[model samples]
Structure formats: structure tokens, C-alpha cells
Target: MFELHLRQKSTAFQIEKRCKALAKVIKARRAPPWPCVPTPELPAKVVSDALIECYLRTNETLLRVLHIPSFRRDYEAVWSPDSNPDPTFLVLLKLVLAIGATTYDESFSLRPSAVRWVYEAHTWLSAPDFKHRLGIPSLQANILLLIARQATGVGEDLVWASVGSTLRIAMYMGLHRDPAGLGPSTTTPMVAEMRRRLWNTILEIALESSLNSGGAPLISLDHFDTEPPGNFDDDQLTGAEGEVLVPKPDGTFSQTTTAIALRSMFPQRLAIVKYLNDLSSRGSYAETLKLDTELRAAYKTLTRTLQTCKTPTNGPSDLELRAVDLLLRHYFVALHLPFFAPALKETEFAFSRRVVVESALRLWRAAFPVPLSQLPTIDDPLARVAISGSGYFRTIAVQASIVIAVELTSLMREEESLGLGPVEVRPDLLTALDDFKVWSWKGMETGETNTKGYLVACLVWAQVDAMRKGMVEEEWVMEVVKAAEEAETRCLGLLEEIEARGRQPQDAPFGTATQGVGGDAVVTPDFGVGDWDYMMSDVLFNTAGDPLSWVFQ
Candidate 1:
């Protein structure tokens, strides 16, 4: 009966009239017959086709059917167990590494099975004989990619041991050509955290290697080291032939027999001279003269060191840069000390101004070879001096302006005390102030919206200093108020632009600042004293203080 049914269904007229009848009979047979033609025996082609089908199929049952154990079993039979572990590991590791590199937004989800597969692969890599069993180069390369991902802030402690091993393997690879390669990944929070734990491991290896090879210290100096020096110095001096003078038991000078002993003892004698001078400086002219002499000596030493030192080829050594920085800072502090402050008056401020100019010029030249326009602007003048190539000239100019502003205010205050009254404001002072204003304004215009607040702060400081010195004339006061008003308006505009660009959903936290501006409606910043508060405080204090009280008394 089944054969008759099949024969009837096979008839061309019956097939055309009812194709469903043949399908039903074929379904009833449970499986295809010998004459029904067997599937092709190209295992590779079959596995490839099955994988493709598995990838394409969306239905749950179709995916399950395509993912049947038989396909993987066949694949394992052909390529597994006997193939070189290196190529196999690399091929699989590349796929695993791709998970982090590719973007996966809200829609995509990693399967638990996929995660398990990655964990297993990592476990295999950690095995003791992995280096020998698998080709080390390919394995090392893949391991580096894995370490990079972890260092780029991808994974946690769960895989950190693997990361350490990978880093060690990379070190073994003699890969010092790219120190900056690790920098980017090390900056990420995940990687940064991992690095904190594993840093000792890296440090141990680096230190050992560095010691053996006579390499530079791990914490060698950079340009930031070249900031202005602070308030102390201990001196060491030697005689012409590198001989040292020593002190006798009775405090008289004596020549030492051994060159090494003389070298060590000469510094102690110099310290005695410094200690005695510190005690003798009892707020008198001689004391001031002594300080001035010491400072001149120190300045000469610092400048000679800076001029004679070789510029680094790769980057400035941190110690060298810091030494320069300390020298500059000390020079400034020395100029400001009560004893040296009068030096400015004697030189008509020329000496002090020249010192500042020379220091700035030297810093600019030493740290950067590029044109000023290419340098980046930063907050610190000393930093600019260290890294002169980053559009830092404008920042230097701004710093110069600030120094001049403070000096002008001080001069105006002193003149008023001398009954010269508030001296008419100079065009130069006004020009410096205006340049600073424009610098800030340009920042805002260029979409550096965050800079507006900082500029406003600087302006407030200038204004406060002027007011405190009683140098703020009525016209100058009015100019400051107008500038503050303009700044406020600009800040409001920038806030609007920030909100517009954000275009966040109504429910999102960042977009909540989009509502309203000015007078009770605007949101106050969480921190910082605002521009208006500073200006108002200055006005209120100046108004409250009795200007005529001293004269009347």
C-alpha cells in the first residue's frame, strides 16, 4: 500500500495537481530511501554551509537544529587534537579579542556560552607548557592583545593573573620600542586598577632589567621638574684642584690629606657659614645684602647648570626639568623677599622685570623647538616653559599680563600712600587687561566653554587686587563691572550651547540644565564662589572701610 501511494504521488500529473500529497508520503517514510539520493560527502563544505545556516537562521528551533553536536564533532575530528596549538589558539583568540574591540550598544548581548568559551581559552593559555606546546610567538601576540584589552579597562581581577603572565611574556619578547603603547591602556579605570595590583610585578621585572642593562631610572625627571625653585639651598664648595677645606677642632680652616675626606668635609664648612649668616640677619641692611649675595650666587649656579646641560633626545629627564623648575621658582621668591623687594625699587623694577623675561625666554627656548603657535596653552608658566611646543606662548603672555597687573596695582597703591592719589591708569595696563579678556573670549568663541569660568576667576582676582590696594578709580571700577556683565552673558550662552549639543532624553540627568537663564531662574554651580559674589564682596568691603579714618586720627 505504501509503495502504491508513493508511486501515485510520484506521477507527474499527481505531482502537478497535488505536490502536498508527495510531501505527505515522503514524511510518512520517516527517512529518504536508497534511490532517493544521499547527501554529498564534502565535510568541509558541509560544515561551512552548516555554520552559515546557523548564523543566518533567526528562529529558535532552526538555530538549535543548525547547532547540533554532530557539526562540531565533525569539525573537531578534522582540525582538532592533531593540529598545531599555536594556529588554533591564535584563530580562536582573535575571535575572542574582537568582542571588546567591536561596539555593542543596547541591542546586542553576549551569550553565557560565549563567555565560558573565553574563560576556557584563558585557562588553556595559563597552563605551564603553553609556551612549548603552542608556538610561543603567535601565542604571545594573542596574549598581548588580551593584556591590552584588560589594560584598556575591559576586565577585572578574575583574569588579572593571565594579564600578568602576558605582560611578562611581552617583556620576554624584548618590546621596548613602544613605551607609549602601554600608556593608553594603563589610563583606563579597569586597566588602571589592574595595573595598581600588578604594578609591583611589572616594576620588579623592569627594575631587574634596567639594573642589568644600565638603563635610566624608572622615575627619571621630565619637563615638569623645571618649575621655579622653593625657599632653601644647602651649599657645597671645593678648592681649585678639587681639594676640600676642612674645619679644625678650634673652628679654624685646615687642609685635608685625603681627597675624598676633603670632598666630604668641604660641604660641612659651607653649611656652617650659611647657619652663621642665618643667625646674623637681624632685619638689617647687612643681612639683606648677605641674602642678595647668596641669591646672586645661587642664580649663577642654576643658570650655568641649565645652559650647560644637554637637552634630551627622547624627552627631557624628569630630574633635569625639576631642577630647572626649582631654580626658577626660587628666583621669583628671592625677588619677593623683603630684602630683595627693594632691589626692584633701586633698579626702577628693571632688574626684576628682566629676570622674569630672561627666565621665561630660557624656559620657552629649552623645552620647545616648535613655533609658538603650535604650542598648547596650559595653566602653569613653568609647565609652558617645560613643554613650549603646545601653543603655550599665549598662556605665557597671559601670565605676564597677570604679573604686570599685580605690579601695577601695587604701584598704584604705593603712589596713593605717597599722596600722589590714584595715578591715572596707563594704556599698557589697560592693554594687558584687555588682552587677557580677549584670550578668555576667544576660548569661549572656539567652543572651549569650560574656560569661561576660569577666565572669569582670573578677572575677579585682578579686580580684587586692584580694589584691595585702593587703586580702583571710579572709571576702572565701572570698566570691571561692564566686563563682569559681559562675562555673565557669555557664560549663559555657553550653557545653552552645551545643553543643545547634549540633546539628551528628557529623562536623562545631564540634560536637566537646559531650563531657563538669569536671575533666580539659572542654576547655580555646585562649587566655587561666582564672579558676581567676588565683585560684590570687594565693593561692599571697600564701601564699608573708612577711607578718611587714618587722616582724621
Candidate 2:
């Protein structure tokens, strides 16, 4: 049995600690025995095939967890007339299908099945003897399970801890060292390349979870000397012993191209995360500028090389471009977030605010080129998957929305002070708010971070609305205010429904209880009760009452 609760802590920087504290929700429980094999839970072959293909097309670009050709061969054997697949491979197969279900459909109709598959895979990995039996397939299963969990919103908040443990395992497996350093007898060229690829994937995911959780990254450049994967597709390297391998030309668009390009700046990104989240000693503004410059240079290299790749369609797809843009621009926002609000008051730091706002705007545009209501007609299906299937990406969108709202408030305040022309809120602000409300409604069904996100969104939206109307008591402003208020009312109602559901008693399904051993029920945070509004206010402002002044620090 387990319960989720907000951590209540006091510190010197009390407001900032309280704001960042929302990210951590601890669970109290003990492990239960692993379930039996999930063979009966497998979907039809046709359905499974479609889901796997979906995962390959959308997620495999960044995740790079599995070699496509190898996985395809294994997949074929799984359905053979007289074949028996390996147990570990079965675990990997389930995870692939679980993640595929999310990418295959934006509505996630198969989410329940996906969740079950993830839990089963997790149990297999949790066995005591599993570490003794660790191999490439087991490592692959661990990585894929993390992706599946993120896609299905299972253990979404605990990804950082899981990734940390995975990091230690990879290091213990000697993946941190380039396989070339090992004797040729120990690893073939194909195995060597796969090792490098897997290590890169592990490092990337670790950094991502660290950023999402606002924790220090477990990786540092000094901690690993593994070389980057070559620019080659899965088919280029045959798995034969003593086989020589050749990489494709730089201009060619191979499967490993994006991963390689990102690795070029992995050190800088790691430094950025460490600096942003480091509690003991953060770098100075000058150091932040240096990282900014390096990141921009790396981004430039990524675009130039990726743009030159001669695909059958002529260039990279829109989703590829958007995904890359959103990812790199997020660093731009985080790099300057500490100085953003201060820049509004001090002309010297205005550049920081400019960077934050511009980067955040670009991030928002890339993440949502079209409004949420028009999702069905979106040109790039991969973009839809990237946005809706991954909890990490959704968190980025929420952060960007808050940035937009904060900026809009500043603009309205300026207009009021100068008695200037009306400040028009960008259309994308409403687009993001609409999506926030949609997510909130979905949270009513699923019950998790989405509800809290929407509640914060509503508060920010109302505050912005008030400021806009105060600038000029106009009819249109009033209309917008009314709409914002209505959204808040609906959001509060949904929160009530969610809390009501959380209060109900339930039997243990996956060997976890809803109630404690002493008949005490699990306690859920009451949004309508004491200090809830104060918490939201703390998120929106700092102790000085300056809007959007709260950064991760």
C-alpha cells in the first residue's frame, strides 16, 4: 500500500523551495512478488505490428533503444509457427507494444493495456537474480520500460530515480567506456556500435529525467569516455564476428544522425542542467552566457547537417524540425529563467528577459504549430505523438505556457503604466490555455499532474485577464475575463471530482493498497482547503510579489 503527498519543508529560500517542492511526491510501500508471464495479454499480431511500426517511426529517433533490423528479425520469429521466443525478448516486445500504443493513437484507447504491459515488464526486471543475468536484451528492456512508463503516465514522477539506478547499472556494465577499448574478441563491430548507441540513449534519458524533475543530472563528461555512434542505419552493420564497418557520409540521413548531432552538445546540456538545479553553488551570469553561446553553435551544426540529409522526401519532416527546435529552445529558457523577472526592472538584465521570452515563444510555436482543437488535421502525426504521448514533452508545453502568460502580464502592465495602445495577447496563449483545460478534463479521468497543471493555468490565465482588463475596461477584455472565470469554475469542479475519486476505498490490484494497514485511508491533497491559493500564488510570484520571478533556484 502507498500514499502520495506533497512534501512540506521550510528553508532559507522558503518561497522557491515551496514552489519546487511540488515536483516531488513520495510513495510508501513494499515490493510484492512478480506476476506470472503476460502471454495472454498480448494483442493480435496485426495490431501489435502496427503499434511497433508506430514506435519505430516516432520514438525510435530519439530513444534509439533498439536496433530496428535486429528487433524486426526477433519480432518475426515470435509469431513463427514452431518458434519460442526468449523470455527477456518477450519483456522487450511487450514494452515496445506498450509505448507503440501511445504513438499509434492520440486518444490512447489502448492505455489500460499499455499500463499492464509496463507493470509486467517492470516486475521481470525487479527479480533478485535479474542483475546476475544482465545482458544487452535486459538493458534494452529497462530503457524501453522507462519509455513505456512515461508514455502511459505510470511512475511518471519517479523516472528520475529509475534513471539514476539505470545509470549506475550501465556504468557497472562498462558501457561508460568505448567498446573499442575492449579486445576485439570481447565485442564485434556491430555489438560495439550497439553498445555506444545504448549508452547514448541512457545518458540522454538520464539528463531528460533530471531536467524534468529539477534534480542534478547523474552524468558528467568526466564520468564517461564512450564514443558517439557512427552515422549508419541499422542495416549497415552485419552482426557477424570480425566484420568491418563503415559509416555513411555526413550529408546522408541515417538513423543515428540525430543522436550523433545531439551528442555533440551533450556536455553543454549537462552543464546547463547542473547549473540550473545545483543547490550548493550555481554559476554566475557570465558562465550562463558562455553555455548559451555553445548551445547556439551546437544547434547551428545540428540544423546545417540535418538539413543537408537527402531523404526520399527531399528534407527532414516537420515533426523532426519541430521536435529539435522545441528541445534546444527549452535550454534557452532555463538558462535565462533566473534573470528573467529581474530584467524587467533592471535595464542591464533586459537581454536575459529577451532571451527567455523569444526562446519560450519559439518553443511554444514548435510544440503546437496548430491549435489543440485541430489535432485531427495536424499534418505531422509524429508531432502529435511527441506532444501527447510523452509526459516530459507535455511538461515542457506547460512551462512554455506559463512563460507566455507571464510575459503577457508584463506587456499589459507596461501598456497601463504608459497609457499606451492596447496590448494584444498572442493567439497562441488562448490555444495553450484551451489545451490546459482539455488536459485538466482528461486528468479528471486519469487523476495526476494534469489537474494541478490546469489549476495553475487557470490562475495564471485569470491574473492575465485581470491585468488586460485593468489596462482598458473594454468590452472584449470583459468577455475574455468571463471566459477565463468560467474555465476556472470548471477546473475547480474537475479537481473536486478527482479528489472525490481518490477518497474511495479500493482493493489492491498490482499488490498496492489504497488504504493503510490500520484502516486509515490514503490522504489526497485538498485543493479547496487551507493554503492552496497561497501555493498557487507562490508558483506565480516570488516573495517580492514580482510575477514569474520563481525559478528552479
Off by over 4 Å in 2: 1-37, 311-315, 374-383, 420-422, 426-450, 470-485, 488-553
User: Which model scores highest in TM-score?
Assistant: 2
lDDT of 2 by residue, 39-120 (tens): 4235767678788888887678766888788788777776665554456666788899888877665545565567777877
TM-score of 1: 0.29
User: What's the TM-score of each model vs. the native?
Assistant: 0.29, 0.77
Task: Supply the TM-score for candidate 2.
Answer: 0.77
lDDT (tens digit, per residue) of candidate 1 on 1-553 = 3234324433322322332343233223322222221111112333333323322221111101111232233334434434322223222332232232111111112222123333433433434553332222233234433432322222322233344454444334222112224344212222122222222223322322222222322322220111111111102111123223223332211111111121222222233223333344345545434544565565555444433433344222343344234323333433333323454467754555555534443433333323333445433322332221112223333444455455556556656666754455554444444444544544443333344333454545456445544554664455455444455555555545544544544341221111111122211112111121111122111323333222111
Give per-residue lDDT, candidate 2, residue 164: 84
Cα error, candidate 1, residue 250 (Å): 37
